[model samples]
Target: MGASQAGGLPVSLKLPGIVLGVGLGGFVDGILLHQLLQWHHMLTGTDSDNIGVKYYSPYTVPGLEMNTVWDGIFHTVCWLAVLCGLALLYGRLAHNRRRAWTSRVLWGWILVGWGLFNLVEGVIDHHLLAIHHVRGGPYRLWWDLGFLLLGALLVAGGHLLQRSGEPLRPRDADDEGGLR
Candidate 1:
């Protein structure tokens, strides 16, 4: 038997996929929204009456700097997640690593991971903690809701697509999906 069994297959790409997806998703959020677009920062939404979060206005230079630092920290965590996911996936593949790289199952799970990231982050940061938003101001609520909606769609889409993915059969693979 294989280490990762799913319906008599050794395809266990779920964990690493989700982890990698989360990291990549965070990169998208940090780069596009935080850096390029300048929509919001880590502490932009702290102005809300959240229980214990300190507010940091992006308007002031010091506040911006603080948010930037915290953003860097967030990016670091995301980077580690990507690294960890890569390590996990790499370690799991014993044979036919090439196919695993291009597997639709992997991609599908990655999308699901990204969606999960968006959903979790949006819920905790945007709605719950009020740390930051997808886009802040009058339409911030709409943007946040859209983010969650997008997450849901990605998860659903990924699930359906992944269901169609077949397990890879390596030339030298044994029962465990590894080199014999």
Candidate 2:
């Protein structure tokens, strides 16, 4: 029930892993919407004709001129989250010796990361600014809200699963998996 038993590594390692996961997920959205899919950065106050049309440059928004300022902000926040998560993880590893620090289920982190991405994106895009809507129609507001809810559930469930899968104290000599 300790970090050493899991893989001779601290539970804090998991934080960087989680941050990397979240950052990757965020990058996908940024690439698709801001670069590839070309969706307007919903938070930037730019409007698209609909879901299928080509995106035009953002109109004037107060002092701001760029259309994807929101995208910039989103990327910044995502990177910051990753950094913060890493710092916390490192700090925990440095100070704590509890073997069973967290859970062994890496999948839990994956799920949590996915959930967080959806939740943050949905909130920033649909609710705070109301740039477009989930897909084009079909009650975008509720859809976005649901996405956030789904993320929360994923995070909660994943953590629970990880805790439940935790191995017992005195590392199982027969185990083969690398430090979780």
Candidate 3:
């Protein structure tokens, strides 16, 4: 579908919004859960079910160190994604001759991107890979399920917001100048 029909924002803008959302979402997950809360790490749930060899721990000094390193790597990847998004946004804005930054469409796409991140990460880390959980304990499954639910909510909310967004207004020549 065309940009206007798709959600009032072009794919050029939507792509960057999603990329930024994923990057920022990753930061939130890493910072809040991994460091601040001390709940889980990249390898916290590894081999918890005896599926494979265990690697690290969240409670021990060495294990924490290793996990910290892995977390750093994860953060680096997130940072790179953010940079890529920024680059894409810059390229689009510079060449498209359209103003997309001030639209709700961008925000909606961002939410969708974050939801996508949560769904993929939650499934991969919490379920399929057994790398870690939102919070470790007997109730881990519940926490993981809750995370997925939140993701679904975000996606739905974003979709609604996107549909409700208006088209971007063209820039007027007289409105370009700053206050005298």
Provide the TM-score for each candidate, comma-separated: 0.88, 0.53, 0.83
lDDT of 1 by residue, 7-121 (tens): 3345578899889999999999999999999999999888883667788889999999999999999999899999999998887775667778778888888889999999999
lDDT of each: 0.84, 0.56, 0.76
Worst 10 residues of 1 by lDDT: 171-180
Q: After superposition, how far is residue 104 of candidate 1 from its true place, in Å?
A: 0.6
Total backbone collisions, model 1: 0
Worst 10 residues of 3 by lDDT: 171-180
What is the alpha-carbon lDDT for the whole of candidate 3?
0.76
Error of 2 at 177 (Å): 11
Clashing pairs in 1: none
- Of 2 and 3, the candidate ahead on lDDT is 3
lDDT of 2 by residue, 35-137 (tens): 6765445433325333343343444453233446656776887788768756655554433324434445545665567667767767756666556554444
Model 3 over residues 38-81: C-alpha lDDT tens digits?
78888898857335747787678998898899999999988988
